[model samples]
Target: MAAEAIDRAMGALIGGALGDALGMPTQLLSPTRIAELYGHVEDFVAPSADHPVSKGLPAGAITDDTEQALLLGRILVSSGDRFDHARWVNALLDWERDVKARGSYDLLGPSTKRAIDAINDGVPPEQAGSSGDTNGAAMRIAPVGIMMPPEPLDALVAKAAEACRATHNTSIAIASAAAVAAAVSSGVAGSDWRVASDRAVAAARRGATLGHWVTGGDIAARIAWAQKLVRGKAEKEAIRLIVDLIGTGVASQESVPAAFAVLEVAQGDAWRAAVISANLGGDTDTIGAIAAGMAGACSGLSCLPQGRIARLKGIDLAEVRALAADLVAARNAKAGSGKEAAA
Candidate 1:
C-alpha cells in the first residue's frame, strides 16, 4: 500500500510536469497555428522564437504549471496540512521574482497576478481572490489531492478551497480546483477513472457552493457534458469538439472541463492524455497538466514512458519523489488517527 501510494503520487506529479513540458511550445498557439508548425505535438519540442511566453525554452522544459505545483507540494509537506495564506503569498512572490531573475517570461497567471497585486495594495487575502475565475487554481492543485484522501469529500473540497483562496476564490475556480483534487485523490486511493470522474463531479458541485459567486458555466455540469461529448468520438473529432465547444482557454469552466474531456478521449492513458491536450491549443499546457495529473493518478507511474520522463528538465526528481513519499506518510498518519478516534 505504501509503495502503491508513492507510485500514484509520483504519477500525478510527474505526469503534470510531463504534460506541461509537452505543451510548452504549443501553449498560446491556435490549433491551426499548431498544425502549421508542429503537426501534433507528440514529443517535447522547443518553442519557436516567436512563441510569446515559452520562447528560448529548451525542449522538455516544464513551465509555470508544473513549477507552481511543485512549489505547492513543498509547502504542503512543510506545513503539514495547515495552509498558511501569508506563506503562500510570499512563495508566489518569491517564485515570480526568481522567474524574472532567471530572465524567463513565464510568470503568474492573470488571476494569481491580479490577486497578488491586490494583496500588495492592501486587499485582504481572503477577499483578494474574489475576482479570480481562471484555471490557475486547478492547474496547481494536485498536491492537495496527494496529501488528502477522497473519503469525507467535504474535507477534501474545503482543503482545496483553502488552497485556492489566495488566488482563485471564485465559485468556478474553486469548483475547478476541487474537481481536479478529488479526481487525483480518488485515483491515489486506487479508484479507476470512472470512480475518480464521479468523485470529481460531486466535489465540483460541493465546491461551487463556496467562494465568492461568479457567473460562469457550471463546472460539474460541463465536466459531465465534456465526458459525454467526447465519448466514442474519433480522436480528431473529439479534439475539434473540445477546442470548438468545450474550449481550452484559461477560464476554469473551459479548461478544467476540457481537461476532463481529454482524459476521457485518452481513456485514462496519461501519456496519450498529455499528447492530446498539448495539441488542443490555447491554454494547452494547463489543460495537459490537469488532465495528465488525473490520468497519472489513475494509471500510476508505470503508464508513463521512462525515456520521455528522463528527458524532462528543470525539476528535481529527487525532491518530487521525497515530497510524494512524505505526503503519503502524512495521509496515512491522518487516516490512522481518524480511525483511532472513531474507535
Candidate 2:
C-alpha cells in the first residue's frame, strides 16, 4: 500500500510536468492560430520567436506552472506541511529574480505579480491576494492536496486556502484551487476517478465558504456542468466543447472547469487528457498541468508515456517523487499524533 501510494504521487508530479512541457509552446495562441501553424500539436515543439510568453524557451522546458509547483513542493517538505504565505512569496520573488537574470520574459502571472508587489510595498500577507480572482493559485496547488491528511473536508479546505491566499484570496480562486487539491489528495489515496471528482466538487464548495465572500458563481457547480458537456461525446467534439463552451482563460471559472471537463472526457487517461489540455489554446499549460496532475494521481506513474517522460527537461522527477514521499511521512506523523491526542 505504501509503495502504491508513492507511485500515485510520482505519477501526479511527473504527469503534470509532462503536460506543462507539452503545452508550453502553444500556450497563448488561439485555436485557429494553432491549427494554422501546426494542424495539431501532439509532440513537444520549441516556441517560435513569434510565440508570446515562451518565445526563446527551449523545447520541452516547463513554464511558471511547473516551476511554482516544484517550489511549493519544496516549501511543503521544508515547512513540515505548514504553508507560510510570506515564505511562498519570498520564493516566488527569488524565482522571478533568477528567471529575469536568465533573460526569460516569462516570469509571473499578472495577479501573482501584482499581489507580490503589494506585499513588498507593506500590504499584509493575508491582504496581499484579496483581490486576485485568477487561476494562478489553483495551478500550483496540487501539492497541498497531495500532502494534506484525508477526511475533515474543512481542514483540507483550510490548508488549500493557506497555500493559495498568498496570491489568490478571492473565493473564486480559492475554491477552484481547493477543488483541484481535494481531487489530487483523494486520488493519491486510492479513490477512483469519479470519487475523486466528487470530492473535488464538494471541497470547492466548502472552500468557497472559507474565504471572504465574493459574489460569484459556484465553482463546484461549474465543474460539474463542464463535465456533463463531455459525457457521451466523441473526443474531438468534447475538445471543441471545452474550447468553445467552457473557455480556456486565466480566470478560475474558465480554466479550472476546462481542466476537469477534459479529465472526464479522457476518463483519466494521463496522455490523452494532457494532450487535450495542451491543444485547448489559451491557458494551455495550466489547464494541462491540472488535468494531468489528477490523471497521474489516479493512474500512477506507469500510465504516463515513456517517450514524453524521457524528454522532460529542466525539472527533476526524482526530487518531485522524494517531496511526495516526505509529505506522506509528515501527514502520517500528524495523523498519528492527532489520534493519540484524541485517546
Candidate 3:
C-alpha cells in the first residue's frame, strides 16, 4: 500500500505471472473470436479447443515469462554487477534440463547463443551481449530493475543492453530492451507512469541511433492509431488490430513497439491493460508480461488484484518479497558508501 520500490517489483512480477496465466487459455484467440466468446476477461479463462501449446496446463501457473525473469533475478543475486556470462549460459542449460515450461536454453535467440558460444571460446562478459536486438533480452529484464533501484534509470538500462547482447546486439533491440528495463527501474524507484514513460522514452531516445522520426514518433503514431481502433470497441478487437497492424516477434521493432503501445496508452492500469495486450494472440504471454510489468512497476503492488497474489508458482511470495527487499538494501548500501558505480 505504500507504493515502495520493492513493492513495485513484487507487483510487476505478480502481474507478469497473472497476465501469463490469464492469457494462456486464450493465447491464440483472435479479437473477433474473443468477442464471440467470453468478453473482457478480468479473471482466468479456461483453455478452449484449438488453442496452441499446453492447452490444459491448469490456470495460475506462469509460463516462461516469470521463469526467465526469476532466472535473471537469481543471476543478479549471485553475481551482482559482475555478471558471469559463461556461468549464466551454464545456469540456463541447467534450468532447461529441469524445464518447468517457464523457458528453455534451447529457446535462446541467435545473438545470445552466439555470445555464449563466444564466451565459451573466451569472449569477455562485457562484450558478450553487444550484438542482440531480440525480445529475448527484454523478456527477462525486470529483475535488473529490482536489483538496482532509486537511481537514474538510464544507467541500469545500459546494463540491461549489455546483458541482452549475449543474444541480440542490434541498436533497435538494445534501445527497446533498455526502454522496458528503464521503465521498470523508474517505476520501482517511485516515479509516476507519465514520468516513467518519459524517462523510458528519454533513455531509449538517447541510447538509440534512430531519431524520433524512426523510433519515437512512429511508435507514438502506431499506439495512437491503435487507441482509436480499440476505442469503444472490445479489448479483443483492439489487440487484433494492434497485432495485425503491427506484428509480434522477438525482433525489437515488432515486439517492442507493440509492447510499448500498450504501456504508453494504458499507463495507470495494469489488469485492464494486460487484457488488451494478451488478446494480441501472438506471443500473448510475453506481450502481456511486458506491458503488465511496465504498468505494474509504475502502479506499484497496490494495483494488483489480491486474487492473483494467491496464485503464484515456482517461488513463494515471501522469497520474492525478500529479493525485492534485498534490492533496496543493496541500493542503500551502495549509495551510502558512494560505491554505486555504473554497471
Candidate 4:
C-alpha cells in the first residue's frame, strides 16, 4: 500500500509536468492556430517563434504550471504539515526572478503577479489575493492534494484554501483549487476517476463558502455540466464543445471545469488526457496539468507512456519521487496517529 501510494503520488507530479511540457508550445494559441501550425499536439513540440509566453523553450521543457507545483511540493515536504504563506510568496518571487534570468517569457500568471505586487506594496497576503479569480491556484495545487487526504473533506478544502491564500483567495479561485485538489487526493487514495470527479464537485461546493466572494460561474456546477456535455460525444466534437462553450481561458470557472471535461473525454487515461489538453488551446498548459494530474492520480504511473516520460527534460524526476515518498509517509503518519493533520 505504501508503494502504491508513492506511485500515485509520483504519477500526479510527473503527469502534471508531462502535460505542462506537452502544452508549452500550444498555450495561448487559438485552436485554429494550433491546428494550422502543429496539426495536433501529440507530443512535446517547441513553441513557435512568435509564441508570446513560451517562445524559445525546448520541446520537453515544463512551464510555470509544473514549476510552481514542484515548488509547492518541496515546501509541503520540508515544512511538514503547516503551510507557510510567506515562504510560498518568497519562493514565487524567487522563481519569477529565475525565470527572467533564464530569458524565458513565461513568467508569473496574472493572479499571482498581481498578488505578489500588492504584497510588495504593503498589502496583506490574505487581502492581496482577494480579487484573484484565475486558475493560478488550481494549476499549482497538486502538491496540497498529494500531502492531504480526501475524507473529512472540509479539512481538504481548508488546506487547499490555505495554499491559495497567498495568491488566489477569491471564492472562485479557492473553490477551483479545492476541486482539483480533492480530485487528486481522492485519486491518491485509490478512488476511481468518476468517484474522484464527484469528490471534486463536493469539495468545490464546500470551498465556495470560504474566501472573498467573486462574481463568476459556480465551479462545481460547471464541472458537472461539463462532464455531462461531453459524455457520449466524439473526441473532436467534445474538444470543440469544450473550446467553444465551456471555454479554455484563465478563469477558474473555465479552465478547471474544462480540465474535468477533458478528463471525461479521455476516460482518465493520463497520456491521452495530456495530449487532448495540449491541443485544447488557450491556457493549455494549466488545463493539461490539472487534467493529467487527476488522471495520473487515479490511474497511477503505469498509465503514462514510458518512452515519452523518458524524453522529458529540465525537471528533476528523482526529487519529484522523493517528495511523493515524503508526502505519502506524512499521510501514513497522520493515519496511524488517528488525528487530524495540520495543513
State TM-scores per candidate.
Answer: 0.99, 0.96, 0.81, 0.97
Best by TM-score, which number?
1
**What CA root-mean-square deviation does each model show from the true structure?**
0.8, 1.4, 4.5, 1.9
Writing each residue's lDDT as its tens digit, candidate 4 over 49-85 gives 8888888888998989999999988887777768888
Each model's lDDT comes to 0.93, 0.85, 0.65, 0.91
Sequence-dependent TM-score of model 2: 0.96
By TM-score, the candidates rank as 1, 4, 2, 3
Best model number under lDDT: 1
Which digits, one per residue and each the tens of the lDDT, describe model 2 over residues 1-343?
A: 7678788888888878888888898889988888777788888888878886888888788888888988987887787656767778999999999999988777899889989999999998778888888888888888887777657688889988988777788899899999999998888888867888999999998888865667767899999999998988998899899999999999899999999998898899888887888788999999999999888988888778888888887887778778888877766676677788889
- Give the lDDT of residue 16 in candidate 4: 90
lDDT of 1 by residue, 258-321 (tens): 9999999999999999999999999999999999999999988877888999999998889899
Indicate the residue-level lDDT of 25 in model 1.
94
Q: Cα miss at 126, model 1 (Å)?
A: 0.6
lDDT of 4: 0.91
Expressed as tens digits, the lDDT of each residue in 251-313 for candidate 3 is 566666677667655655778667766666666677778878888888777778886668644
- Superposition TM-score, candidate 4 onto the true structure: 0.97
Question: Poorest 10 consecutive residues of model 3 by lDDT?
Answer: 210-219
Residue 45's lDDT within candidate 1 is: 92
Candidate 1 overall Cα lDDT vs. reference? 0.93
